[model samples]
Target: MTLQLERDAVLRRHIGPVALAAAVINGVVGAGIFTLPAAMARAAGAWAPLSYLVCAIAMSFVVVCFAEAGSRLPTSGGVYGTVAFAFGPAAGFVCGMLTWMASVLACGGIAGALADTVGTVLPGIAAGPGRALVIIVSIGAIAFVNMRGVREAAWMVTAATLVKLVPLLLFVAVGAVMVLSGSVPPPRPITAPHVFGLATAVLLGVFAFSGMETPLAASGEVANGNRTVPRALFGAMGFVLVLYVAIQLVAQSLLGASLGGQAAPLAAAAARIGPVARMLLVVGAALSMLGWIGSDILGAPRILFAFARDGLLPRVLGRAHRRTHAPDAAIVVHAVIAAGLALSGSFTGLVVASTLNTAGLYFLGCGAAWVLHRRRIQTVGEPVDFRLLPVAAAGGMVAMAVLIYVAPPAEILGLVGVLAASIALYGIMRGIGGRARPPVG
Candidate 1:
């Protein structure tokens, strides 16, 4: 018990429920929300909003399982810790590796989005070394903020979340007023092709919900994590679901058929109000992407830190700064890797690959929840029924499996190669006496 407490003390417990909720909100609401309306409209027509609601309902099951697991472990590495306890070191390693990869790729994708948004406002920023510089600087600044400490980083996330959400809410409010006043035209009836379109939109909607698990990654640093983490997760999910559905409704109401071809549907919707609204929407998009980058940098490195803590990697990577209590080395390593990926100019492909990889990882997490429940693992938070755990786990796994089938073949092949490499690396680490020790409860 002393050893466990000593280990826990290494990470400062400064994140409260509000900050944790902010982290969750920031994680799930990335650059995707700014652009997804057009794609969903193109696929599902007037039914796009329904697709978001359906996907949200499906994702709630997974979130419940994650909450139970996270509350049980209340440690850094989120799913990594849960798998390590329920399965073994090998499964845990693979879970952490896949999650870490997805986060890095996500950061790269967001950085590219930020560059593109900036270039739209100020031309010449997207071409040549200018684009690369913007990506690096953006990522580097977020990393520096995170390196300062969790408290500072959490505040930054909260600020960014508020900044990005205002414009979205404003657009929704305007559209709602128009509808209530009978100024907006009614949406067209769904056609035969729209049924298939709903399926596609649901798939895309599920992908947008991918980052909800991020707050749990830093559980060790959260005050009252056992309770706070779960509350934050559910709260953030509910908030995003309402916001997403509202945005979709607004976009469809205003843009109608024109929404299908719009590259920036929300911004275009805002333009219906005027140029100032359009400019504000663009700024919101930039802030939204920046918030995601900040949140990813804050969450992803905890996996490496957890791995190091368990002896899967060098101990130095797990070391927190003396004054700031931040995982300095791990944060630096994540920044370097993400910056390298951003320069590759494969942001869209990387996003697709990471989406598929994340689905598999979430499935593993559901399995871990089931195993933990069956084993009756002692938890510090509210106890969940063993029967409920299995039901949620099964439902989440099935959802993820469906998502996997929808993934592109090229991304699946890439995932396979990455898994193979992880296996080889695991073997090498084991040979060198680097096998991780089991977590102490």
Candidate 2:
């Protein structure tokens, strides 16, 4: 009975094409609208837009792997779920744990970023118990909204996604107007860098497209899970790539060398237009942060739910909310973990550490995809209609490995610790349950 329990989840088919597309958009167009421009400007200089193009091109392979593998498996475990179905319980547990830990860390970073910025618009948000209250309240609201159902959750995500994109679109359009008229100054030559520097910058830029696989999470909820997952993956990746490049082109083209030095790169670009544009960009930044917070609160907990259902985590987390049909327990667990990190003063460290951990997990996912692809011939029936998924997955693995090396040392160590800890936790869980014990779902 216990062994059978893990395989007994009901497939609801609540999400449709719109929901999947919106989730893709939500996953891709995150807080980076405000934060990434500055980082890209610093790392790649005048050719930051070029970095956007390169990164987009590189992520194609990763996107394809995720799409194909997710469609074929159609499991709630996501990357780990696919791996677990393909491999075994032990592999699944580690993959699930690492993915969940990465999600929690990333959510904390997004929340921290929002908290600091909330200080700008609402002055009292940064100090005393006031700040903690705001963080807890904000996250709790998102949690309640998500606890409703995936269909409703997807609607919420879609709305937030549109709100985030509006500001970026305005910034790009406004910058173009400034440049077209004689109002903006002309761009000057930005001396190019060595090949290695350029390549390294491009790798991190590609990493910007990191979470594009998120629509895969909707696989369980999606109508025709086998069909919708791949389509949404491609659509989301293309949309974000276009947005990133367009924003970079308008901003860097108009501001040139000046783009790199500003506290708020988009706002600074807007300043070239006039004070109004600057104000709009600031408001947009706030919206972008809010959108990111919303996306994290919605997406991260799903991965944890996947973990818990696989017997890698406490059984309580695997139980769905009977009324809402949502993964309420996993949502609450991750929210608490992330909220604690957000209230602490280590936002920068968490962001760095999370990115590193994410890189490691990504590599594992890619490798698992590769394994599944190579062994496809062994499966019954028409080869399971396997594609060049292994090749695409291998490319993704290589890309993430390169990014890991380029990341800061502290980040590298933090990720190493996360992986090691996840592995140890898995062993402890297995021992407590003992052999022949059925996996929980």
Instruction: Estimate every model's Cα lDDT from 0 to 1.
Output: 0.78, 0.67
Task: Report RMSD (Å) for each prediction in the order shown.
Answer: 3.6, 4.5
Task: Show the colliding residue pairs in model 1.
Answer: none
Candidates' TM-scores? 0.85, 0.81
lDDT of 2 at 406: 74
Model 1 TM-score on a 0 to 1 scale: 0.85
What is candidate 1's lDDT per residue for 261-285, written digit by digit as tens?
7656788788876789889999999
**Residue lDDT tens for model 2, 1-441:** 001113325767677766787767766676755655655676677667787777666577667777666555555546766666556666666666666666677677667656655654466767667778877887777777888887777677666667677778888776777677867768774556555556555644654676655556546556666667777777777877888888888877767776666545677677778888777777777666666766776777766665566555678888899998888898888788888988884444565566566666677777766765666522111223346676777787887787778777766777777678877877877676664122223
List runs of model 1 lying over 4 Å from the truth: 1-6, 9-19, 126-130, 144-155, 179-200, 221-228, 305-333, 343-348
- Model 2 gets an lDDT of 0.67
Model 2 bad stretches (over 4 Å):
1-9, 14-18, 119-137, 140-158, 187-204, 261-263, 305-310, 315-333, 343-350, 377-387, 435-441
